[model samples]
Target: MSRVFDAMMEGLRGNLLRMGGRAEAILDKALRALWERDARLAQEVADDDVEIDRLEVAIDEGVLKALALQAPVAEDLREVLAVKMIATDLERVGDLARNIAKSAARSAANPPIPFPAALTSLARSSQRVLRRSLDAFSRTDAELARAVLAEDDAIDRAQDEVVESMLRALERQPTAASQEVDMIMVAKHLERVGDHATNIAEDVILVAEARNIKHAAKLARNR
Candidate 1:
């Protein structure tokens, strides 16, 4: 029975990792479409959401099964619950990426707006957070997970700068409002991606250490 439970846990981790990998890919492709103004790539990302949706369903079922059959306790219980919650977050993250891709496809022919430097930085920073959080979960490294939380501040700052720059650009040239709106939407998506990754990292911390550091994270970063 113990062996069966252990195998189930392993399977759970494998499936969750697969979902995470696909979610990360979705964000990457979405950003690519936005920056390069490639309608084809944006369409491709929008279509890929079907796969992510399927994975979310599978993960949900697996979590329910683990809870019913194994009756996980302590860290094991945390892992099971975390898988369920993280799967939901990853699914939403995928949707946010797809939303950006859809917007990119719509604006592909509008003559590329002057690209904002802060937008690029936000995307890169969010991407790093997602990658590092996944790595921390794979290694069960709480310290690495905590560092990812710290990096969220950088993402927030970048988003703020992007908003300010966009506002200024709009004020200077009201004709550019249409383009500025899309740019702000893209930056907002990237910021939300960072937020979802932060949620996942929080789950990892709770699962591995039984520590609820989420509230602390908000206060610490605000300070």
Candidate 2:
């Protein structure tokens, strides 16, 4: 029974990793579509979210099976809980990416706004966070998880800059305020992606070290 439980845990890990990979791909494609102003590509990312939803369901099932069959304890319990939490976080990340893609597709219909460097930086920083968070999960590297937490400040600053720039644009061109609002919304969604990535990284830290590091991350940032 112990061997069976171990094998089931391995399968659970594989499913969670696969879900993470899919969510990461969704974010990458969404960013590319936004940067390139490719409506078709953006729509494709939105459409692909159906698959992400399916994967979420599958991940939940895996978690259930692990709990029912393995009755995990101690480290095993932490691992299973982490998988469940991370799966939910990845689902939210996928949803945020899809929202960004939809905004990108909408922007394609309007006259292209000069893509601000701040917005571009925000997207790049968020993509890096998502990638690093997944890598930390895969390796159970607490240091890598902490690094992801450390980078959140840059993402937050970029988000602030992007939103402020859009607000200024709105004030300058009231007639085109609607388009600026859409751009701001996209920036907000990307910021949320960064947030979800941070949450996943925190979950990895908890699973690996059995310490709640999220509060520590916040305290360290303030210091």
Candidate 3:
């Protein structure tokens, strides 16, 4: 029975990792479609979102089953619960990536607007943070999770600058207003991606250390 329980746990972990990898790919492809202005690729991303959604459902179901059957204690319980939370966060990332793809499709319909350089840079930063956050979760490294938390403010600042720049450009060129607004939406989506990744990192800390550090993340970063 113990061996059976352990095997189930391993299967659950593999499912979680696969979901994470696919979610990350969705974000990457969405960003690519946005940058390339490929409506076809954007639509593909929207379609792929269903798979990520399915994975989230499976993860939730697995956790519930584990709870009902194994009645795990301490570390086992923490891992099962934390996986559900991580799946939720990853699902949000998928949703945001779909939004980016939708925005990209809309922007592609209009004549090209002046690109916001800062926004692209911020997108890259968010992707890096997300990758690191997932890595931290896989490795159960709280310090790496802290590094992910430390990068949140940078994402916030970049989003602010991008929005301001887009607003100014819209004011000067009313004709490109629609596309400029789409740009802002894209930037905002990417910002939310960073937030979700940060949340995942926080969940990892809780799962590994059995401590609530979400509220204290900012204070730690300040130190």
Candidate 4:
């Protein structure tokens, strides 16, 4: 029974990793579509999201099976629960990537506006946070997870800069307001990707240390 439980855990881990990898790739393609104005790549992102949705369902079912049959306890229990939470975050990331792709397709239909360098930097930063969070989970490295938590703020700041700049551009050239709005929405979607990455990092810490720090700061402030 113990050996079977271990095998179940391993299967869950492998599926989670595959889902994470696919989410990351879809995000990259979505960003490229936005930057290069490639509508075809944007369309591909929408199609790729179906696989992510499927993996999330599989992981959810596996978690239920593990709890019902294996009855994981202590660290094992935490690992099983965290896998479900992280899978949800990865699924949301895929959804956000698809949203960005939609924005990309819309932007492609308009006259090309000057894409902001800050937006590019924000995309890269968000992607790094996601990759590092997945690595932390893969390695069960609490320290790396904490580092990902620390880096999320920078992505937020970069996103703010991009949004503010886009707003200014909108004011300056009201004729291109539609295109500028798309850029603003893309910045928002990228920030949300970072937010999901942060959630995954927090789940990593939960699994690694059995600590629940999801809203630690807010909770402390209320006290």
List per-prediction Cα lDDT, in the order shown: 0.87, 0.87, 0.88, 0.94
Colliding pairs, model 3:
none
**Per-candidate TM-score against the hidden true structure:** 0.94, 0.93, 0.94, 0.98
Per-residue lDDT for 60 in model 4? Answer: 95
Q: Per-residue lDDT tens digits of candidate 3, residues 1-223?
A: 4886798888788888888898889999998888888999999998999999998888888888888998999878888888898899889999999999999899778787767889989999989988998899889888999899899999999999999999999889988888888899888998999999888888888887998777685688899
Off by over 4 Å in 2: 216-223
Best by TM-score: 4
TM-score of candidate 2 versus the correct structure, residues matched by position: 0.93
Ranking of predictions according to lDDT: 4, 3, 1, 2
Q: lDDT by residue for model 1 over 60-158, one digit each (tens)?
A: 888888889889888889888888888888898899999989878867867667878998889899999998888888888888888988898889889
lDDT of 2 by residue, 101-134 (tens): 8888878788877777899888889889999999
lDDT of 2 at 179: 72
Q: In model 1, which residue pairs have backbone atoms overlapping below 3 Å? A: none
Total backbone collisions for each predicted model: 0, 0, 0, 0
Error of 3 at 124 (Å): 0.7
